[model samples]
Target: MCSEGKTTPKIVRGEGGYVLEDVPHLIDYLPDLPTYPNPLQDNPAYSVVNQYFVDVNDNVAQKIVVHKSSPRGMLFRRAGPHQRVCFESDEVHACIVTCGGLCPGLNTAIGEIVCGLYGMYVVRKVLGIEGGYRGFYSSNTTNLTQKSVNDIHKRGGTILCTSRGGHDTLKIVDSIEDRGINQVYIIGGDGTQKGASVIFEEIQRRGLKVAVAGIPKMIDNDIVVIDQSSGFDTAVEEAQRAINAAHVEAESIENGIGVVKLMGRYSGFIAMYATLASRDVDCCLIPGSPFRLEGKGELLEFIEKRLKENGHMVIVVAEGAGQDPTVESMRSVDHQDASGNKLLLDVGLWLSQKITDHFTRNKKMHINLKYIDPTYMIRAIPRNASDNIYCTLLAHSAIHGAMAGYTGFTVGPVNGRHAYIPFHRITGVQNVVVTDRMWARLLSSTNQPSFLSSKDVEDAKKGATDAAVGRGE
Candidate 1:
């Protein structure tokens, strides 16, 4: 089933006892390809380690805490230096491209990839695709080396500029073939990973000796099959600063209300985590949870009650919250950007206005409201300590997998262990905040209403959001 790319993903499996979400290898098709000793076997840095090469059949279990009667469940190929490799040092020509919007660890990921290929494998002749998918055919390539990327990790955003849409798979594959590129690295969010999957399919259909590797990167931490993605820690850390500022402003005045809109695309992870960390947020709103500003399940009434108790309150809202057609039907936008994403209503601005109107005119209460939309700021900063370390692990894992001739795979931590996941298992998938222990913790910290029914909470745990904030389908 893995050889033909027909394995069911673990998260969606209902009745299956157990499954292996294995990735593809060059030997699956090019059976006659010769092997070479891993370059790491002689590297001094690795000689100090107790164990290095991972066994070929080694895998990580996706679910460890199953019922006594349940099977071992899904497993993914463990990521590490393989005992043997297929690509020789000189024949490996690699090109990297970053797509979608800015993420905190993008530059760090790019830097680690370049350094891993150069320092460990001694692979020269690496190219950086200038501007996402279109960069393959439309723009020039930048020569990448350890020296060039040495200080990039200290910077923010991708050194290789990114963009949205304009994903021409044919032309991009053609460029790969024309340039004799055998290894491809793509870094992006969910939509970009979907594009990478199509590119992998094309390469497979053509029977090319190419390896396409995806680094699952979404600052929202909404990609499925992984415990968490890079940039999430950094985003959460940066978001706390905004929450702190908002708290200061709210507490310093009478009848003060602070509204902070966080980025979760179609989910509520960022808002949820930031609110939990702040400890001052009185309310939090996210998608898949039914919330109404007005009605029997009134959020405004709760806000009023909270203010009466504390004299000040902070509200944290996910970008995807309040997106119900019934709430925003008249203002539902039909326009899309170049990436073809549905332009969502700015819930922050509208909520601010609603709060202002309800207090100043509707209730005849004078109030001071501060709305902070740190959507771009949080993601645009450099990677934090934890995320930088995470980026290093992901980058090296991807480099090792690609160099060992693994293709059509994405690298990420599954159950806190790095593993090579197939493109089919993760593409078009989204991970949402569930009413789990963590959500319960957030509720306790914020002391806010559940804002959702039991069924809606179940729906939130179903999976990732279909429509991202600014990216395409």
Candidate 2:
């Protein structure tokens, strides 16, 4: 058998078969199991691609394009194969990195990746890149092994740590080559995934054989066509606790307004789902649905009416809500994070102040408003049972896809199945709440006014008609 320096393995026809290459480093850490000829020999799926041991020219295929024949359209990601195999078990050296903000399931995903690579592929040289993209060029790396990460899933933050910004793709590629790494598993959100695509392209340009795979990790649940990303379910569950607290605080006082601000840079799935789960929410405000601040039966009138009838009310607002039309004029966009996401204005606090002013000016009742912003608390907790399982499955699928030679794609849940999707298709897009279906349900359950002004009512009617015509109803 040929070594790493050789192009291919030499086949011997006279002998019973070609000898398996001796990779002592890969086998030294594993236990001897004489009873089983091969741990994965029985399963063809996990068998080595170079079983024949012949010299063949390197021929890489084009990207794996999945096509479906359904009128209603198919799952954005569907079941598929990698179309090519890049590396064998022993010759592969892999690295796993996490980027962007904190999420509930980050640690679990890390543990799953380490365990799957070591246990399934017997990969010994697995390194953890620290502090996101900066860790690639810097001297910050953590050695990963099966025993080292056995109980990491029980924790919250990433074992390798993470950071934003610092997207030097060329330097990152130099670091990968310097470390002799052949496969990379990146767990992050949209911005981080875009950086991964650049790194993958640079590796190809350098004539190096490296596989890059991404596991989508959006807590906002805003990646298009992905049914659900890791950490979303856990975030929704944690937000419910805050909503419960708001309900209690609002009920204890007279004319109380419990305001909750959730984390959503440009989407509002967290706020929407939390409000839906906690039926105590009187009004749900999101980035997708805009409401009037003044006029007959508007936000002020709705709160006043609710106070007169029930004496207290709970209002849930997404951080990105009411920004474009209402809050943008009142507030200035001065700051941005390392990941390039604009720092949102404090909508919850602004709304609370406005409510207090309107009530004080009326001189009818006093306003006892309670503001709750639980962004950090929700993002720091360990993964719940559902998210833990979801993270583990995503990690396994990522390892399989990376070893199978898939590049520039992220593993996501599509139609309740783990599927690989190209990064470019979903990078700039967003998964928003369907107003007609989801907002209609929220309005019905909360009994809130659909539209506060004449213009809003006209827009709603036009939207309904457009939707009906599209659906051929």
Candidate 3:
């Protein structure tokens, strides 16, 4: 039988599976659905939707009823007007918190956020969440005000205290929702930013109106988007200071050689920048450089020659410098330090040991190996003026971005310039090794060590050979 409405084939259940019967196409048979009346037709929500309609009250006397369905069904009535009433109160029961490793300018960032919100924005009820995400889930919080943040900017560590672990994003969101917090400012590194973004997304998904902002913080300065991470400049400055100290010690000790290791696990920016700043480093070993496991014997031979010829050696090695095999082996050994912290496989220490062993084999040579680890010292110093200013700008930019409803973003300086970039832009950006051009420039620079020269290598070999001959028994 032909269909009565439209002209197309429609599916019909038959004795078998299904059969196609003649029917109308969708466009020919479809009927329009009724439009729902807006609940806030007389309020701001009506204006926001920007729809034009005649008032039905005038026709009500005719005894007619209008039936319609909303996009959200009966729940459409709850989509109220976007009023500023929630933010009008003087008591802002909100808070700011920081978590993770100590990054430079952390305290300053926190202080600026609190002061900006409370003093300028007039948000008074501010609290600090201690121990990071843990503090968010745990029952640990401290009230903060303008006065409380005044001295905190000068501090190095976190004012609210910090813990490495605790609550996940959903848990923190649930806790904050329960506490009636309308907004939160999270100051932290990449991990913390990820957590904050997840929480923000979850809150939105749950239909809650809460704003969250993240300030980029990391000593590694590896966070993408910002020109530089918060603690990077400070770390570089501290490294330079330590390098300067090492140079002075080397000169004072007369014929003394010192090997100092700087922190830069996957990238050698710290070592490179420090080498550039400190003009006396004899040799700087960084990841991605020409120095590798295959070249270790040659490097040790070169170092011995430099010590014998110059009477003093100064080497700056990145903490991440070394061959993959040695580093991997060290990791497998599960070494631990006195503080219960995992003792990282230090490439500088390994290189130093190799040099020491090489010099020892040459009994005639009197070379002393002084290994100075500046990792802790560099990260613990007070932030320099440049870093503090940069961090303040980053924090301000982050807050402003949040206020503007930007999400999944990072604020920091890039290529020595202050800029903000999307977090997703660098979500999987690889940390490449230092390029060969940079390596060549560093090698040729008068400020850095010329230890790879032929003369230096020859002298080291001679020293080792002589020592071996003298040790003949």
Candidate 4:
């Protein structure tokens, strides 16, 4: 029987032992009753955050349902007790792969997974799949151990390397079967998780029992339902240096406009937080909160007023902001990356030129503008202390999920707790900045003219309030 796009195979006892009752569901691996009962119950190392681990039969309360169309949710429960893995340590072959763009905590997350598998699980056949899915078919596998990854967390990039393409699900599943890979840990963003979910589906269709898990790696904090993705804190912290530079440039010159473009292809948390941290921003633009190019109480008017009042201005714009109006020229020749994200038009340069043209056309005061794009610098830095802890939690939770026979899920913090979120729930959505909640606060803090209309503000506030109520906060 198929329900919710997944095959629901019932277990039955046969001459060959427990087997899937449906003939169509016959696979190489069969589910067995969990043994080594209470394996970690008395383990000394289970002292810290032991509540995260749960018995396989222990159903949890507090189900968070999301997206009625997809109809997926997570049960908040303990996801740990390192000793109680689903696969036999000496027999299981586990592989890990990283995909998509680099994030600040990729290495930290990789290190935690390697250490947990080698040290905690004592898994003898731990392998790293290099360059993402492409590594599966190619001869790019590497042997991993706790000793090999001991200090990798102190670094920035993933030691396993990562890429975005080669999403051939059938071929990937074939490689998994050929390599005897029972557990796969995928570290990536939405696209990578989607790929993992597809691979899981293929494995299930072929009646294979390989477990696939994900740890979210979105630096923009755009993955839906996740409170914070890894690298956001570090990105925000590193963006501050750029913001400080912009502030100094603006302050030192007459009518200088320091324009900064930050990463946030679909969301604007980085730009919004950086603006708040700088505390000297005259105008801020984000993808979620679009502003008029030239109108009363719009972006240009606010910048002009700020220049007249303070003789200098600073503006922070998310890379995706004003796509409809400002990016028309760049869109004609735009290309997509292997992960399928569009090459974003240079919004910062476009905005700076607009400011210069406005001053030239109107014969207003001459303007000095500096545009800065600090995306690469921010992405290359090591994880901050806060993100380091977050990555560790996600990694540990992912390992727990995989060892417990859970698949097609991404480990993330939800409602301030680390939990398992089904990849289907986060497949095509983004956690955009809540205008009523965050943008309102930003506007008030900056004392800038209201860019959002009264009706829009009211709706945003209502949405925020309803979300808060749902969270019981």
Best by TM-score: 1
lDDT of 2 by residue, 1-473 (tens): 10111112112122332122111111122223111122244346556655421122221111224245312222223322333344566777889999999999998999898888777666788989998888988889999988889888888888889998757777888999999998899999888877887776667667676778888898998876567879999999999999999999999998888999999776888988888888999998887667778888788888989999999999999988878654465757568888877878888888887888888888888889999999999898899999999999889878766665556567777556566666654465353444458877888878888653567656656765664444222
> Which number leads on lDDT?
1
Candidate 3 stretches with Cα past 4 Å from truth are 1-92, 293-297, 328-343, 414-420, 426-433, 436-438, 446-473
2 or 4: which has the higher lDDT? Answer: 4
In angstroms, how far off is 138's CA in candidate 2?
Answer: 0.8
Off by over 4 Å in 4: 1-34, 37-43, 47-78, 82-84, 329-334, 454-473
Give residue 15's error in model 1 in angstroms. 18
> What's the TM-score of every candidate structure?
0.92, 0.81, 0.70, 0.85
Q: Give the residue spans of candidate 2 off by over 4 A.
A: 1-39, 42-85, 325-331, 452-473
For residues 171-221, write the lDDT of model 3, one tens digit per residue: 787788898886678777665665665665566566554556567777876
Better of 2 and 3 by lDDT: 2
**Whole-model lDDT values for every prediction:** 0.83, 0.73, 0.59, 0.75
Residue pairs in collision within model 1 = 430-464, 431-464
